[model samples]
Target: MDTERLFDRSYERVLSHEVDGRAFFEGFYDAFLAASDEVAEKFHDTDMDRQQAMLMKSFYHLLSFYASNNADYYLDRVAISHNRHHINIRPALYDLWLDTLILTVRRFDPECCDETELAWRLVMTPGIVYMKFHYNRDSIVGS
Candidate 1:
């Protein structure tokens, strides 16, 4: 199957009863916070519940960017928000984010394998690239 098809199916499994709603996302955050002190410190004052909610929503936008091959308004806004002038998320942190997410996927998605994990990485790359691209720009494309 194609990358999109593989990712779509596997991602569904991640959200299914086996993993349960919110559990996978919650677990990802837990692992992410412990993955690196930088990550934990970055979110030191964050409201975790709200942050997890945002992450769940952002996953869709990231997939949309991969499927559409364009950073649409929503993704653009996200990139802008994460830009150096705003949240100041460093470029290297995106690598950690992607790695952490994939590992978390492996844990939550029992069906996860090399292909599925690669698909997740491939799918999230565009959005991560877009965010990294805007790290210095600090402005959205059509804004």
Candidate 2:
């Protein structure tokens, strides 16, 4: 099956569950903070309301990228923004981020299933790859 179609179906299933976006992010942050003290410290001075909204938009952009491939623009920007010189989003953090997201999805998304989890993984792979590449590249340059 095509990736776009699969992602759309899974995304629709999640949305159809009628999960509140705000509440979902709150739960996600709770889980994420518990998973990593480093991640929590990074956000200590940040405004969560704005960050949550941006995270939702970024996820939607990631899902949409499978279809249009246009969302790759933001993906690149995200990679650049997370580089070592900026937010210093290391590869390990991406693993933690994905783990937290899946856990939160299982908690808040009533439609969560193996397929939904796979969709999230598949859809996020490209952006995560990009972020990891840039992080490594920046690390090399810094060294």
Per-model root-mean-square deviation over C-alphas: 2.0, 4.0
Question: Mind giving the per-residue lDDT tens digits that candidate 2 earns over 91-122?
Answer: 89999998888887787666567877887788
Q: Of the candidates shown, which would achieve the greatest TM-score relative to the real structure? A: 1
Minimum summed lDDT over a 10-residue window in model 2 is located at 134-143
TM-score quality measure for candidate 2: 0.78
Off by over 4 Å in 2: 1-22, 68-71, 138-143
Let me know the TM-score candidate 1 reaches against the reference structure: 0.91
Residue 87 miss distance in model 2 (angstroms): 1.1
Query: TM-score for each prediction?
Result: 0.91, 0.78
| Candidate 2: C-alpha lDDT | 0.73
Give the per-residue lDDT digits (tens) of candidate 1, residues 18-115: 34455877878888889899889989999999998899889888987888887777778888888889888899999999999998889878888999
